[model samples]
Target chain A: MIAPGKLARLVATNALSNRRRLALHTFGLVVGIASFAFFLSLSMSVRSVFLEEIFPLDEVEVVAPRVGAADVDARDALNDDVVNEIRQHPDVKEAVPRMAMAFPASGAAMFMGQRMPFEAGGFADGVDPAYVADEDFADRFVDWEAEEHEREACGPPPERECGDHYYCDQRDNTCHKRVPIVVSRTLVELYNTQFAPSHGLPPIDEALEGMLASMLRLEIGLGETMFAAAMTGGESPPRQVEGMVVGISDKAMPIGVTVPIGYMERWNREFVGDEAAEVYSSIEVVLEGREAVAPFAGWVQDELDLSLADRQGERFATAIFIVTALFVMISLVIVTIAAINIAHSFFLQVSERKRELGVLRAIGGTRGDIRTLVLAEAALIGVIGGLLGVAAARVGAAAVDFAAHRWMPAFPFKPDSFFLFEWWIVAGGIACAVVFAVLGGLFPAGRAANMPPAQALSQD
Target chain B: MAGDPIIRLRDVEKSYGPASAPARVLRGVSLEVGSGEFVALMGESGSGKSTLLNIVGALDVADRGHVEVAGVRYGEAKERALARLRNVDIGFVFQAFNLIEHLTCLDNVCLPASFSRGKSPAEVQERGKEVLGRVGLADVAGRKPGTLSGGQKQRVAIARALFQRPRILLCDEPTGNLDSHTGGEVIEFFRELNERDGVTLVIVTHEQRISSAAERIVSIRDGVIEDESAGAPAAKEAAST
Candidate 1:
């Protein structure tokens, strides 16, 4: 049983004797570990962005036939009974009914009667104001009134549309001053990418002022006389009214807008009368968490016989994660090959130092001591390589993130980092490296330990 | 030289190859050396003089024998026990001066102590310097074996063998690789060490000149010591001077 001090000294002496070999071993290992860590961190970062920034994990949207089997209108679909049935689900956090206006918003108008038209049609769904105040993402929302003097804090006021009452944008999900119209984030993205270029219009640069002086239009389809005229393209629906744009939400809202439920109730009462307008178009079901979505959606389909749509847009998120995971596996395969090289290098080293080992054995050194000495050298390599790999991975990821932000500023859902190296990742990375190194040294150590003293002494 | 024999071997036999056609190296050989006597084992090439030394040092095991060193018998002792006995009771100086090239002279000297249980590296290192000084190579303690001359390397090897303070010193043609002048110096140094330190010495060599310095010169032929009368008391008195 050699003392640890003596063993360490032996390991150090032998390891340092072949400086060039040790350096080569460590360099290959460092690159392998760095690539592994880089891919692992990248997958985790993208997953985090998908969960935290892209969509709320606990919500789904539902719709059903309104009034009767022949009903083709959203104004009478998914009424109070359907909303109540969904609310009874144990996993459901809230089942807010989506209220629809009798007519869609056609254009935006100023006090001077200047009308700005949207390139395509749109719809306006009304939602509960109280829900937006509670569940909204505050940072992404642009508030117009708080710093009226600081209007330039965001951008031009041509897009700043605030009403005296609540209006849910369903774009950024942040609370703002009340209005009658809300726009979805999908609408904004579509307008910039597909809509702007073909229509010869400038793409939206900032979220706050992009849709200034614009009229989010919808094809009217309500009432007997107005519906007939709208069907014939003779005249627009009589139940039309323009409302200002208000708050933005993170939800993947449908085509047009989101107004307050209270405003919808009042407008429906005045135009269509209470008996015909008390019905809702659809309902939004917010669940406890992602785990509840499956069960709740199952109940809605089986028991209620209603269609539960995935408004969360998680399929794109899944595809992104799967691709990232594939890359991570490829990196690990590279690390595996590098570890094999490490094993080969150690075997060569042991073979090269047979004489030295034999001399030690001849001087009362045991087989265990020689084997331990070799393993200790391997562990030293792991520690140094693991540390270097971690630093290189971090710096490498940061460099890529910096480049991405510089070249593509408008990248959708971009996070602060493209590599999220949490504490566990660091710990796991080092542990993995050490395990690989130990595994690499095992066979060589066994070979050295099993050698006969005479054979070793006789070896070149 | 009044103490009982430090090393005793009775009918020790060693051979290689198949039992039916064995190439016997030692055939029922018996010898004994008393305390503090420098005995030389001499033979021609393949006479098994080195084999005898290896068996005495516990580096090689006799095929059929009763062997004892420092009052501990071999064959019954476990391999580990025998290794421990070799570490503590016998020291070997090989012809090649097998100093580990990577280690400093001091580390090479301290090597034996590191293999022994209950020995601290610090204590071993401290004692290594003392042994190096005794062998007249204290100034080269920090120098690597590669940097040392042939004579210096031999001295370092001698120092390493003496580092653990073993009772018996076994040299297998210790001056085989040195020049004539360095060989003479090393042989004289060995004689002085045996006389002054009172350590038992067994030296195997082919040269009669080297053997003349020892108290007894026993020749091996056909794996047996020459004769019992060759261990006469008169030889001890003549070489002690």
Candidate 2:
């Protein structure tokens, strides 16, 4: 019948009377909770890197097997018909087909007074605009060649009647619009972390990256690269193409560049053949949710006779999940042992306070009151220990980050910190602490409540 | 003793230990004390005087026959109902002055009211302070029992017992732990409370000086009442005070 507020106050007062013992018990609980929080956060961070940066799991890329590699069929090839078929599936949100440049190509760019050149023979691919439609720079990533009905002519090669965001093509002696291209965020990270430092260039940070669309431009040689020059014969004269960086995306190719598919069809037809323009290299199928991934991937392989380009994301996800669960179980075992210690401590406390409990009974306290008092004390300990545990985990994460920065070697896609402390994880850790502590206190509280008042009073 | 008695017992019997070899502590003893009366139960160490007090206060159950206090029968009562009966209708003062050592004296005094329903903390606290003031230990309310003298601790215990204003205050050798001078002072406090507030008192003791202040004395021998008699002349003088 005691008021809840007063009962809480009474519990606080009783717990405060034994500060040293409570602190010692709480230390054990904090260690368990800290280990749980740290392991969970670390797993989440690692999983994020794999799922978001290295291999985006929500979208699966299905590639047709090479001719004669499998039981080959004409229908098994990835083209517009197959793309439309995959797009209409119940679980498939969208299916975007991609065409790789069938001919040799290479590119060079000058940035911050440094000329960086790279070969892109089989790396460049043309992606459907729907793939990057969600990006912030989607409006700029369109086929400029298709938009221009007729080429505009002017005086000379370098000086032409080109419009805004357009340039002159010296090969055709006409004003040709610059093609918009996108590169993967992973490429930029690699440049900033590994390539820039080795080449003595200023690393591109977020501020410089924002200016990349206007500041960096590349001259792509469509044919007759260094590799193509080594061929026997049947090579065309190289034509110069200009492209401007539009935006970075996870959907872009990791090692090369991605332009709108319209440019690919035109260039492939002009350089290779009409067959090369019609046949797509791959199709990226985006599902509505992760729950549809397994079934959709199975359908892609079985019904469509296509293979997923990468299942490493899902495999890595599963592996990270299992490791996280193992760590959490170990943490739970630690917490359970701490709870057992708490029970032993409470038992000792109840034994010591037997006469006081009897006096409370003599003064009209019910058995339920005694039980609640003990449990409330346990909950208080849990809250204190849980909060301290969260703090300790945060400190440990910072220390690890500091040490990693000082001692670890630079690598591609290295995260800023290895821990991701989300609100739910911290709250869940505290709730677990409370639940474990209450479970530990149950038997001791019951024993205290069930003691006979007269016999307890008779104790010395 | 007039009107219906506040406490009634009929042929109560009690024993302890295993059923194979029981140690009988009370045997077919019946007694009653009227409302607002002062009575003392006198007995030897193993004569069951304390056991009888415990049974009457709802702290123990009688093994046989009926026991009733403040119109509630103990035979058919549940533990919860018995607890309520003990909380509302009876108070106990112990020989050890058993205050919870962790709490302030005021908190100890408010213990009974803390367990009762429908009273806010402020109301209970105000009443606790008033009871401590009544027992002349108001200034020591913030002090722990460990900081108080034996007489002061007993006063705090008495204040806690009176917090609920129970109709019957049961005392089991309340002055047993105090020196003679302090014991006399506590006995005088009980006499004043009984006379001024019309609170019924059932005190268990073997000390003759403590028994002399009661209006009636019942002596027990070998787990049964041997005789009953009037108190000494000090009872009349005590009543006048």
What's each prediction's TM-score?
Answer: 0.76, 0.93
Best by lDDT: 2
Give the best candidate by TM-score: 2
For model 2, report the TM-score of its A chain.
0.92
Report the C-alpha displacement of residue A111, candidate 1, in angstroms: 16
DockQ for every model, please.
0.46, 0.65
lDDT of 1 at A247: 39
Off by over 4 Å in 1: A56-103, A107-126, A129-177, A180-260, A264-300, A306-321, B2-37, B45-83, B86-89, B116-124, B216-218, B221-241
Alpha-carbon interface RMSD for all candidates, in angstroms? 2.2, 1.5
Displacement of residue B117 (Cα, Å) in model 1 is: 6.3
> Could you tell me the fnat of model 2?
0.67
At residue A32, give the lDDT of candidate 1. Answer: 73
